[model samples]
Target chain A: MAELDEIIHQPLRLRIMAALHALPASTGLEFARLKKLTGATDGNLGAHIETLARAGYVAVDKAFVGKKPQTTVTATAAGRGAFARHVATLQEIIAGKQP
Target chain B: MIDSQQASAALNDINDVVHRVRQSRIYQNASLIIVMWGALVFVGYLANYTWPPQGYTIWAVVDLIGIAGSIAIAAFSGIGPGAGAYALRLLVAFLLFIAFGIFCSAVLGHFGPRQMLVFWPLFTMLFYALAGLWFGYAFIVIALCSSALIVTAYFYAGPALLLWMAVVHGGALILGGLWMRRI
Candidate 1:
């Protein structure tokens, strides 16, 4: 059985990855919107996002929409691949296909 | 340390996230756009009957108004990145459909504005179906009903056809928007 990805194993990060993966490739969600979806506090969400970014699992892009600084997060191709593998591993375990 | 129980929990977590995202109002902006255009078309058809001699002029004004309104709504539709990209693609598809319709009409020459009315609803139905499929299943029902209305309009022409289009196409969009909002 494939091992779980440590980067995506945390509950909050897992939810974040799941939401991003649901979208089409190269597409992203705004930071505020993501916070609403994940129900995570700003500091908590930012920390997990930072960890994922460091692991090359997600890409964070910051820009100014007018004068307000807006941050958008997209799952990298590597992140998507890792998430897929992680999900598959979970499924395998759930199905009792892995000992 | 992650056993089957943990695995099951993770799967549920993933499912919850996907469900929430799908259920979110990411396409609210596009939905409102549809409602706006539908209203314009409805009012335009009503005006066509109300002023029979100026049918052509009424339609021209309606088209111009529609173009302007669409530009305004599109500018204000504050959508997130992913949903915004999808909406942009839909816009491209809509423009392409209009171009194709115009080309075909020019080439065919024999097909009059009445026939184009029928074609318009069919195209609109197709677009609604695709959009509904992407956003939610409610739109699929709207698409199927619009198809029925399209068939009805095709068989009956003149004032009666316009009325039918107005009632069905316009009604679907208005009602669909309300329904989405309620959800």
Candidate 2:
């Protein structure tokens, strides 16, 4: 949950995680569509996504799709576990738990 | 300075975690919509018997198409985008509409008075709603507009249907556009 204090609350980060986690991993264009779906811009989505990738919570692969360089992102096992605990923590807090 | 780096790292992690949860929710919502639509289609078929024509054969064929298409979509969700699958959804929905027109006009012709077909718009509306909720808001809105046109042509005539259809289409697309923009 303390790790989540570092991760979840930012708008763009929330969106990138939401996108990658859903498809597990998808192309940069796919992520961009999700970003648009969640109303975030390219720079914003990239920066937040980079932060997660750097944390080892997400893994990003850069590859070629036809002639274009594409990035695909996926959540690590650690990332999934972290997210579940974070949700549990939030639920606990909602049910009147103290820090 | 050290605290600032730690804070930034913490925030990034939080975002990563929460976003995954949100996407999972969207996936779950999509599944629910599919289930609900299947149920609706089944019930609609049951009600189809009340109409003038009891051509179980054609209705069964139409129902198979619907059921197969729904299963294909459900299966495709697991296999990622499935290439041109999204476009196929639109094509399938359009074909269904044409079949609906043929079925109602030709087979159900003996419904006596046109007033009894009041269920036409209602049925089409429900279909569009199912498609919209399953596919996207745009699909539902467009389907509603198209189906309304069919209803108008059959039940009413002249420019009134045209004017009303314009209004219906305009309102649906406008509302859907605004909703998408909001999202």
Candidate 3:
């Protein structure tokens, strides 16, 4: 309950997780593009990524993309594991009570 | 700029609509594919009755194959969300069989086994080529090769067209499976 609660209870972080989880590895701008695609602002997206990084659900690395500060982010193995568990819980919710 | 929340909500709505549309298409196409196939069978039956071969029961066999093939398609459901795409491959394979049945029935009245069998591999090469638009070259090549082998082996026997068709779909399965790897 706590983990699933952690995953879906937050709005911006949920969007961040969902977007990156849906795609292959992506940079901050790519994540930003996804956020833009998914309808989240730069500030909101950055905040969520930080939250996920703090929670060890995401890992961020700083680098330069064409001389511009590029922050690359990926779901950590733990984060992916947590997301899978969260999804199973979601599926259980959709299925409604063990048959 | 669009409101992020609103855009997200709109996209969610769009996803829902797309989901419904896809379900509708699978259902509608299930029926449509059967009806189209049924029409083909009906024609085959008419040909059987109208052009009664008397000695050879091949027409009756062709008619039965047509009915059975269409029913199989309806039963298969051509893939769905729960099962992923493999079931679709089966459905498509059945469809290729249905195509083969049509080809067989068309020449049922007169064409011999050798000539009849040739249609599958050569044309399936083309069919798979066109399938390349939807499926690609590996699938096309697999279909072409498989169909050719079956036709070659049974080049002398009964309706060998189905083997060629098997290649079309066998290739599709092999190719579709590989293509799915990239995705």
Model number with the top lDDT: 1
- Candidate 2 lDDT over B1-183, as tens digits, reads 124444445445556644644444344434443444434443443444344265345445645675556555555545455525754764677568757765776688645333333344456567767856764565565556646654665566543433343344334434443443333
Question: After superposition, which runs of candidate 2 have C-alpha atoms over 4 Å from their true positions?
Answer: A1-4, A19-29, A63-70, B1-66, B79-125, B130-140, B155-183
Query: Per lDDT, what order, best first?
Result: 1, 2, 3
Q: TM-score of A-chain in each prediction?
A: 0.98, 0.77, 0.77
Error of 2 at A4 (Å): 4.1
DockQ numbers for every candidate? 0.37, 0.15, 0.03
Candidate 1 residue-wise lDDT, A1-99, digit = tens: 488899899999999999999877887988988898888999999999999999999999999999999999999999999999999999999888887
Write the residue-wise lDDT of candidate 3 on A1-99 in tens digits.
323446433656655565555533332324544455446787877877888888888888878789888676777777767766765554444444322
- C-alpha lDDT score of every prediction, in listed order: 0.79, 0.53, 0.51
The residue ranges of model 1 lying beyond 4 angstroms of the native Cα positions read A1-99, B1-5, B67-75, B81-91, B154-158
Give me the candidate number with maximum DockQ: 1
The runs of at least 3 residues in candidate 3 whose Cα sits more than 4 Å from the true structure, single-residue gaps closed, are A1-3, A24-29, B1-183
TM-score ranking of the models: 1, 2, 3
Model 3: how many Å of interface RMSD? Answer: 11.5
Model 1's CAPRI class is acceptable
- Docking class of predicted structure 3: incorrect
